[model samples]
Target: MGESDATIVSMILAGDPRGLNRFLSRYGHMLAEYIRALTGDDNDLFSAVYEDVLVDILKQLRVLAGTHETPEIKKLSGKGELLRPIFESAARTVRRRFPDLLKASEEPKASPLPVDDLAAFANSIDHVDFKTLLEGLAGPERELLVLRYRLGFDYAEISNIIREARVQLEERLVNARHHFRARLFASQQKAMV
Candidate 1:
C-alpha cells in the first residue's frame, strides 16, 4: 500500500531474504493476533501454528515469484487443505511443552471487552471470538470472517487467500458479519455484570 510495503513486496518477489524479515517485523504482530484468535486462546498453540503458517508462506513465496506476483496478492477460495492440522499439532505441542497450561489456557469464552469501552473494544478482542464462534458457522464462513475483519483483508485480498471469486467472498463476508454480530452481541450481554 505504502512505499515501504511496495518495496518489501518487491524485495520478497526478488528473492531477498531481508524482505521476508522486514515484512515479518512489520506485519507479524497483526498476523500473530489473527492466528492467536483463530487458534483460540492457546498462546503456545498460536506460536506453533504460526510457525507452520510461516513455513507455508515461505514455501509459497517461490510459487508467488514464479508467477510474478507480489506480497499484496490474494488467493481464491477452497485453494488448499484446511489448516486445522496446524492448530491441532500446535495444541499437541502445547500439551507436550506444558501439560498444566492446557487446562488453564483454555480458549476464552467470549470477546474480552465492555461494549462502551471503545479503546478496550478495539484492543481487547482477539481470534478467540471467531474460533469459539466457528462452531456456529461453516468452515468457509469462519475463515471469511477472520480474513476480512480480524486480518484486515479486503474482499479482494480475502479472495486471494481463499481462492474464491470476490463476489462470493463478499457474500461470505456478509454472512460472517451477520453471524458474528449475533455472537458478539451475546458475548457483550454475558460480559455485562
Candidate 2:
C-alpha cells in the first residue's frame, strides 16, 4: 500500500504524462465527486470547483516534491489519506460560500442563509456536556460527530476525510449518533432527579 501511494504521488510529481494521466483517470471522478459534494452539488459549477480542488491538491503535492515530507506522504494509507487535509481545507473555505454561491448560481432564486447561522452552528457544539458525551465514543465515532456536527461536513466529505467507505461511514454515524443521544438523555434524566 505504501509503495502504491508513493508510486502514485511519484507519478504525479515526476513530470510524466503517463503517470499523471493514469492517476487522473483513476481518481478524477472520485475527486470531482468529493468537490461536488463540498461545493453544493451545483452541476454548472462542478467543473470549475473540481479544477480548483485538483490544482490545490497538486500544488500542495508539488510543495512536498523536494521536502522531507515526500516519503512521509508515501507512507500514508491511500488516496483518501493523502486528500484528507486538502478536503478539510476546502470544507472550511469553499463550503462556507455555498449559500451565497448557490443562490447566485440559481439567479438568486435560492434563499440565503441567515448571517449568524454558521456562528450559531459552531457555538452549538461549544459545550462541556457535548464534549463529555463525545469522550464516551470511540475514535471514529467521536471524529464523525465533530466532523458532521461541528465542522458541518456531510457524510460524503466525512467518508473521504476519515478514509472510510461511504456505506460504513453511514452505519457508524447512525450508531454513534444514536448512542450519543441516549447518553445525553440519560444525563438529563440524572440532572432532573
Candidate 3:
C-alpha cells in the first residue's frame, strides 16, 4: 500500500529528503491542475506558480505538519486538507505576480444576452449541457465553478484561494451560474429549431 499522508509528513519533518520527492510525486498533478485552472492555462504563469508552491511547501514544512494550533496551519489530517493552505498561499503569490490577470478575472466582459432574458433562461440543465456551458464561461468563472463543485471547496476556501471577499465570491459564482444556464438554454433552443 502507498504511504499515508501522515507518514509522508513525518518523513519530511524527520529530514528525509526522499519524503519531499514523494510529496511532489503524489500531489504534483493536482498542483498543476489547480494552477492551470486559476491562471487560465497560461503555461508560463503555471510554471512560476508551481515553483513558488514548491518553495513555500518546503519552507513551511514544519508548520504544515501542525507544529502550532493557531494561524495558518490548523490541522494536518490528510493530503487533501494539507494542500488547502498551500494552494491558497500559492494563489496569493500568483495574484501578486500577475495583478493584471487578477483584474481581468475579476471583471469579465458582460454576456451578450439581456439580463431579463438571461435570467429567464437560467434553469436546471443536463450534465452534458452543463459541461459545455461551463466550458463556454470566461476563465475565472470556469475556475470558480470547478473549485466549488469539482474540487468540493467551500466558499471560505475559495475566497482565500481567489483572494476575494466571501460576498464578492458568492456574487461572482452566482453570475457564473446564471451565464452557464443562459448559454445552455440558448444552445438547447438552437438545437431544437
Candidate 4:
C-alpha cells in the first residue's frame, strides 16, 4: 500500500484501524530511536517508555480523528506533514513519566547536526544559510569544527583525530565560530543595508 502520508493521516483521522497500523509500520523505528535518544542507553527503559509514548500517540490520534476546525489539517501532504504530533507526544510522555531522564537530557548533548561549534550562528541561520556559511569555512578550520550536537563526540574526538591537545582544538573551534559569525553578521548587515 504505497499511499501518500496525507492519505494515511486522513485514514487515521477518519478512524480507520489500518491507518494507524500503516503509520506505525512506517514510523515505529523513528519513535523508538527518538525515545532512545532522549532516555540514553537504559535498554530496559525502552519498552516502558515506548509503551507509554505509544499510548499517548494513540490517544492523540483518537482525538484528532474527532477534530473539525484546524485549517492546517487540510494542508498536510507527505510523511513530513504527519510526524509532528508523534514527536510531541513522545516528548510529553517522557517528561511526565520519567522526569529525571527528561531533566538530564535538557543539558546540551552532541548531535549529528554541527550545532555546538556554530552555536549562535546555527540558531540564527536557516539550512541554506548554514550551508553557505559552511562553504566559507576552509582549511583545517573546516575539518577541526568540533561537532557536539547529537552523537556526543566533542573536542576530544576532533583533537585525537588531528593530533592536537583538547585545549588547542577547543581554541581553534572558538576562533572558527567567531570567524564564521563575523562573516554571517557582515552578510546580515549587507542585506539590511
lDDT by residue (tens digit), candidate 2, 1-193: 2235556677677776665676566556656544443343357676776666567667766776564356665575455455556555444434444334322211112223345454643455334376565555544455566667765678887877656699998997887787776665555444433
Residue range 82-152, candidate 4, lDDT tens digits: 56566557656766787665331111222233334446544445533654554455433433332333223
Worst window of 10 by summed lDDT in candidate 2: 102-111
Error of 2 at 162 (Å): 11
How many residue pairs clash in model 3? 0
Tell me the lDDT of model 1 at 154: 62
Local lDDT at 9 for model 2: 70
lDDT of 2: 0.57
**Candidate 4 segments whose C-alpha is farther than 4 A from its true place:** 13-17, 67-73, 105-193
For residue 191, model 4's alpha carbon misses the true position, in angstroms, by 48
Clash counts for all predictions: 13, 0, 0, 6
Off by over 4 Å in 1: 1-20, 64-142, 191-193
Report the C-alpha lDDT of model 3 over 1-193, residue by residue, as the tens digit: 2766666667777778887788888877777766666665467877777787777766666755554333333344456656676667666666666554444333334435445554444542343355555546666776777778777789999998877899999998998877766676677555444
Task: Name the top lDDT candidate.
Answer: 3
- State the lDDT at 137 in candidate 3: 67
Q: Measured by TM-score, how close is model 4 to the native structure?
A: 0.47
Query: Scored by CA lDDT, what does every candidate get?
Result: 0.53, 0.57, 0.66, 0.59
Using TM-score as the yardstick, the better of models 3 and 4 is 3
TM-scores for candidates 1 onward, in order? 0.50, 0.44, 0.64, 0.47
